[model samples]
Target: MKPNLIAARKPEEAATTHPTILRTVLEYLLDKGVQPFVGDSPAFSNFKRVVKVTRVEEVCEELKVPLTPLDDPIEVNGEIFRKIKISRKVLEADKVVNLPKFKTHSQMVMTLGVKNTFGCVTGLEKSSWHMRAKNYDDFANLLIDIHRIVSPILTVLDGIEGMEGNGPTNGRKKNFGIIAVSRNAFALDDAICSFLGIDHLVYTVKNARRRMVTPEYEVFGSFSSTIQLPSTVSTFERFSRAFSRFFVKYPSIDKRRCIKCRLCEERCPASAIDISKQEIDYQKCIRCYVCHEVCPQNAIKLVRKLI
Candidate 1:
């Protein structure tokens, strides 16, 4: 995707990184003599270019910290994935500090620290894994496997500005006004979920709990209203109980809102979306919602697929 085309399509959420908070962390890292490389690969190709638009590059540059692009891929020889490529910097890191914005995800239910690491996979490899897994549960397993491999030393949830609705990317930003930190992502995510009072059916949450990946965690702060959940979160438990093939939710594009940018088509891991026709083929869609996440115009909507 073109860097100019990949601009932040919506208004900046108040809960996004505050200069003071980010500076505080950077100062701490610098004081500790920790050489930090702050960078993230966006949902599309050319992360170095994408970061330029996010303006995160400016922050890193001002902090005098190196912004490392996760462009170089390193093959991961692991169970379930014979040859999955991850970012070289992640592998080289002595310690990984996971910083994830609290957002409700269309597929994973929530994009917490565990799900945030998916960015480390580099560009199209992220889409390839979705196509390979093909099922949400299997995809969740793939995420868990990658997390185990990367094994971030710390996880910090930037819930001060969180997103709900069809998110991780395209959603209305809410001021969640909370920051959570934990050594374990699973625990931190669970704590965040509990604080939100949302259901526990999140794929990463379920998988993490089942594998006993979460240690004891606690929530300190409180919020007035409960966070709104994405429409796709309901299928978590029902997915295993019955077929409900027709009851599944699928991503639909709003042509009026869509700029015909083809971002959805390019980012779709299942290759189920055809922007030319302005339709998503549910038969091929794994409901991964990568299209929804990357759509620069917020054109994609999750609607129930009626039989």
Candidate 2:
């Protein structure tokens, strides 16, 4: 089987390299008559906005691959998930390739191959999921369920330059110039966790393992190279558990970085955030980390505390 390849590059180098990335993936799949579709649910609240910000449409056009926007909901696991939708084009395609950006996640620690599929859920549905899942374990289950259904034939990580500290958005960018790919999402993510020197047990990747997703799964080619990431930080899950906090290490407004934009509060699903005083109500908090994930200023930090 031809292995799916994930390449890494700096976001600043996008103009020079995105076309190559697009062409390589599209042609490889298209040559086998396997339809290729690229999609991601960015932290920015809307899929279209993500596309615009990433210029994915231009990349699709350049590669002649079709661009699909998933907007209809589908039921999974007896849950009436109105936001759980997938691209029809991807669903119908013989092969699905996932292109995910590598970055730190306030809730999950890092958003890599497996977490990228959250984009398949449509519009406000992504935010609603935070409320539905409520806690770390339940939310991890939801993510696993989505992965079970979407089941990308291949996953590629965009780790050339990824976010760290507080990420998925609103964090510092670091250069980890390596590309990785694999047939199995679990294996792909496992490799990334290893490369980053993070304990798989501390990440959702470990949660994936409890759900039986493992690194032992078959892999295609070896990673092109391993890039060094910055110094490590505690995963929110670990911080929450160790600190004995009901707050679950949710993002708190960094008054130094916050511009008082209210974006985090507006987008928060639990409405646990108070923008007026820039305070978070830990009692009402759900630990979704959406505020941290979506903050424009990277002003949110996952701090542990009890209500």
lDDT of 1 by residue, 1-307 (tens): 0011122432264323443455567778899989887755565646555555556666677888887666699999655666878888888888888777777778887877787777778767778888788777788878888877878887776777778887767677888787788788888887777666654567878777877777876666655557767777555434553555546677889989999989889888777888889988877887788887777677888888666
C-alpha lDDT (0 to 100) for residue 28 of candidate 1: 84
What is the per-residue lDDT of model 2 for residues 90-209, given as tens digits with 9 covering 90 to 100?
A: 455565667666676656767777777766665567788888877666776677677767887777666666666655455566776766777787788887776556644335677778
lDDT agreement of model 2 with the native: 0.61
What local lDDT does model 1 show for residue 115?
A: 78
Best by TM-score: 1
